[model samples]
Target chain A: MAAAALREQLNALLSSMFASGLVDDQFQQLQMLQDDGGTPGFVAEVVTLFCDDADRIISELAALLEQPVVDFDKVDAYVHQLKGSSASVGAQKVKFTCMQFRQLCQDKNRDGCIMALAVVRNEFYDLRNKFQNMLQLEQQIQAQQ
Target chain B: MAGAASAAAERKVTIRVLLVEDEEIHRVLARALMKAVGGVELDEAGNGAEAVRRVREGGAYDLILADRQMPVMDGHEATRQIRALGVTTPIVGLSSDSLAADVDAFIKAGADDFTPKPLSKEKLNHILAKFNLA
Candidate 1:
C-alpha cells in the first residue's frame, strides 16, 4: 500500500513538471529509451548529460561575450548549439532566448547577446532547480520502498 | 463508511510515466498536474536521443508523452526508434498542431495516442483514461 502511494506521489510530481514547462519532448524521448536491454537509469543519465551540456554551453557563451572584441561568429556558433540543446530538451523559453541571442550575434550587438544570456541563464536555473526537486522526490520515494 | 471504502477503492495503481517535451513552461506545468493526480511515477528527457537513452537504461514505463518537433531528434524518429528497440510501453504524441493529418502521422510513427496542446487538465485526464493509466 505504501509503495502504491509513493508511486502516485511520483506521478503527480511528473504531471506538475509538464504543467510547469521545466521539461519538454526530449524528456519524452527518455521514456522511450527504456525499451532496450542493458540500459537502466536512462532518464537520470540523460538528464545529467543535459545538465552538463547546458552548463558548458552557458560558460562558453559567457566567455565569448566577455571578450574585448566580441567574436560574433563564435558567439553565434555557441548560441546555435545552445538553441539546439534547449530545443531538444523542450526548454522552450531558453531556446527562444537563444534564438534572440543568435539574432543579436548576427547583428553584432554584444549588449543584446549579453542581455539574452541573462534570460537563458534564468531559464536554465529554473529548470535545474525543478529537476533537482524531482530527483530528490524520487530518492525519497525509493528509500521508502 | 461505504463511501470512504469506495473512494479508497477508486484509487488506481501507480503508472510509470515518461514525459518528453521541448518547452520548459509546459514541462513544469505538466509535472505539477501529474503530482496532483497522485498515482504516477514520472521521468523526463529533453530530446529523442536522450529519451531513447533513458528508456534503454530504465525499465519499461507505463506511459510516454512526447512532443512532435525537436532539434537533436524529432518525435516521429524517436517513436520509430523506440518501436524498433522493441519497447512496448504505450506512447502518446503531443503537439500544438490541431490537424487530424498530424495526429495520424503520430499514430503511424508508433504512438498509441495523440494529444494536442495547450494541454488542459481535462484533456490530460481524458488521455490517461483512454490509456487506462488514470
Candidate 2:
C-alpha cells in the first residue's frame, strides 16, 4: 500500500478505536509528544514499553493470585503499576479494569479480586494487540516516507 | 549554606532544577522536558532520600520535581523532610496517582504543585511561570 493510503488507514483505525472506547485522549497526547526534534516514534516506543510492562505484570499477577494464600498487598502493588502504565499510554479500558481490581485488592476479597484480575489481564492483551497494530502501521508509514 | 546558594544563584543565568525520580526513563523524560524550556541547569536524584540529602547540602535550586512514589522514602515524606531542613525551594510532585486525597497528601506534606505524567509542556511551563521559575 502507498504512504498516503497507509496513513489514511491508520487514521481511520485510530478514530474507530477511540470511538469504540479502546483508547482515549491520552493516546492522542502521546502522538503529540512524538515529534522530539529530529527524533520520531516516541509514542510507539513508550507504548511498546507499556506493552512489555503489562505482559510481565500479567504473568506475575497470575502466579501470585494462583497461590492458596494470596498476598493482597502484592496484588495491589502489581495492579497499581498496571494502572499507572495504562494511564500513561491512555489505555483507558485497561486502566479502568485496574482501578476496579485495585479496589478489590483493598477490600481483601480474594474471589472478587481473582475475577477482576482475569478481566484486567484480558484488557491488557486486547490493548497490547491494538497498540502493536498501530505501531506496525506507524513503521510502514515512516518507511514509505 | 544559604550564602553559598545565594552566590551560586547570582553567578548563573540559568535556572537550576533538582529532578527526583527513581525510574531512569522518567528521569530522561524530565531532563528532556527541562531542555525544551531552555535556560535550565538540571540535576537529578534517584529517589526521595537522595533528594533530601541534596537539599541538605544546599545549592540554589529554583525548583524540585520529585516522583511522589519511590522506594526508601516517598515524595511526601521527602517534602516534609526537606521543609524540616529549612530548604524553602519550591517542590512539585511528579504524581501518577492524581486522586484528590493523594494530591492532598502531597500538599499537606509541603509540595507546592504537581504535574502528572506523561509530562506536558503546557502544564509544566504554567507551573514554572506561576513560581517565577520561567
Candidate 3:
C-alpha cells in the first residue's frame, strides 16, 4: 500500500479494533506517547515487550498448570502480570480474558483454569498478530516517506 | 499579576529529575513529559540498583521516577536504599500494580508517591506540582 493508504489502513484497523473491543484506551494512550516524537517506534517497542513477555509467560503457565497439584497462587501471580502487560499495551481482549483466568485460578478450579488458558492464548495471539501487522504497515509507510 | 510574574521570572528556577526504568520507552515518555512541561533536566538509570548508586553519589535531583519492578532490584528496595543513604529527594514509583497494598508497599519502602503504569503526563505533572517543581 502507498504511505497514505497504509496510514488509512492503520487508522481503520485501530478504530475497528476498538469498536470490536479487541483493544481499549490503554492502546490509545500508547499511540499518544508515540506521537510525542521523543521516541520513534515507541508503540512497536512496547508491542515487542508485550509479545516476548507473553510468549514466555504462556509457556511457563503451560508447565505450571501441568503439575498434578496446581498452585493457584503461582498461577494467579502469572495471570496478574500478564493482565498488567496486556493492559499496558491496550490488549483489551487479552486483559479481559486474563481477568477471567485469574478468577478461575482463585477458585482453584483446575479444569476452569485450563479452559481459561486456551481463551487467553487465543486472545494474545490474535492481538499480537494484529499489532505486528500494524507495525509492519507503519514501517512500510516510514520507508516510503 | 505583574509583580508575581516578575518575581517568578527573577528566580529562573530549573527542575532536575531522575528517571529510573528498565524500559527505554518509559524513559522516553518521562523525558518528553519533562520537556513539554519545560525547564526540567532529566537523568536516567537502567534499574533500581543503578538508581540507588546514582543517588548515593549525590546530585540535586528534585524528583526521581522509579519503576516498581526491575531486574537488578525492585523499586521498593531501591527506595529504601536511597533513603538509607540519606538522600531526601522525592521518589515516586511507577508500577502496573496500583492495588492499595502495592501502593502501601512502595510508601513503606520510602517512595513519596505511587503512580500506575504506563505513566502519563498528567500524573507526572501532578507529582511535579505537588513538589513545587512545576
Candidate 4:
C-alpha cells in the first residue's frame, strides 16, 4: 500500500476504535508520547506486554475457576490485575469486563465469574486483533517511507 | 522549580526521578513522560522494597513515583518506610485504582500526591509543578 493510503487507513481504524469505546484516552496519550519520544515501536512494545499480561491473568483465572472449590480472593486478585493491565493499555471493554468480573468474584458467584471470563477473553482477543492490524499498517507505512 | 535543598536558582541540571513499578510497560510510559518534561534523569525499581533500599542507600532523586500494587511490599509501605528514615523527598503514588480510600491511604502513608497509572505528560507535569520538581 502507498504511504498515504496506509496512513489514511490507520486513521480510520483508530477513529473507529475510539468511536466504539474500544480504547480510551490512555492509548492516545501513549501515541502522543511515542511521537515525542522518537522511539521505534514504542506503542507496539506496550501492546505486546499488555497482551502477554492479559494472557497470563486470563489463564490463571480459568485455572482457579476450574477448581472444585473456587477461591474468591484469588479470583478477585487476578481480576484486579487484569483490570489494571487493561486500564494501562486503554482496553476499555476489557477493563470494564474485568471490573464486572471482580464484582462477581466478590459475590462468590462461580457461574457469573465464568461468564465474565468468557466475555473479557473475547474482548482481549478482539483488541489484540485490532492492535495487530494497526501495527501491520504502521509497518507498511514505514516501509513505504 | 528547584529542589529546596539546591542553592542555585537555575535549573537543577537534571530532575532526578525514581520510578517504582512492577509493570515494565508502565516504566516505559514513565520514561516517555519524563522525556517530555526534558532534562530528567530516571532510575527504576521493580518493587517497593527495592525503592526503599535505593532511597536508604542515598539515591538523591528529586521525586519518587510509586506504584500502589506489586508482588512484595507495596507503595504505601515503601512510602511509610522512606518517611520513617526522615527522607523529605516528594513521593507520588501511582495506581490504576483511583478509589478515594486508596488515595487517602497512600497520603497517610506519606505520599505527597497520587497519579493514576499510564501516566500522561500533562499529569506528570502537574505533579512536577506541584512539588516544585519541574
Off by over 4 Å in 4: B1-12
What fraction of the native interface does candidate 1 get right in terms of contacts?
0.00
Residue A16 lDDT in candidate 4: 94
- lDDT of each residue in A17-125, candidate 4, tens digit only: 9999999998997787677667678889889989999999999999999999999999997888888878877899999998888889889999999999999999999
Best by TM-score: 4
Over 4 Å off in model 1, which ranges? A1-6, A35-38, B1-134
Q: What is the per-residue lDDT of model 1 for residues B18-128, given as tens digits with 9 covering 90 to 100?
A: 888765645755664565455667788888888888887865788889987766988888999998889988899987554799899999999998977645446667877
Best by DockQ: 4
Q: Tell me the native contact fraction for each prediction.
A: 0.00, 0.09, 0.12, 0.59
Using DockQ as the yardstick, the better of models 1 and 2 is 2
Which regions of candidate 3 are displaced past 4 Å? A69-74, A106-109, B1-14, B23-40
Ranked candidates, highest lDDT first: 4, 3, 2, 1
For each candidate, give its TM-score against the true structure. Answer: 0.49, 0.85, 0.80, 0.92
Interface RMSD measured for model 1 = 12.2
**Which candidate would rank higher by lDDT, 1 or 2?**
2
Q: What count of clashes does model 2 give?
A: 0
lDDT of 3 by residue, B1-134 (tens): 23323433553797788888876545655665565455667898898899888888776788998887677898889999999988889999887768899999999999988888766667766887798775
Per-residue lDDT over B78-110 for candidate 4, one digit per residue giving the tens place of the 0 to 100 score: 999999999999999988778899899999999
- Give me candidate 1's TM-score against the actual structure: 0.49
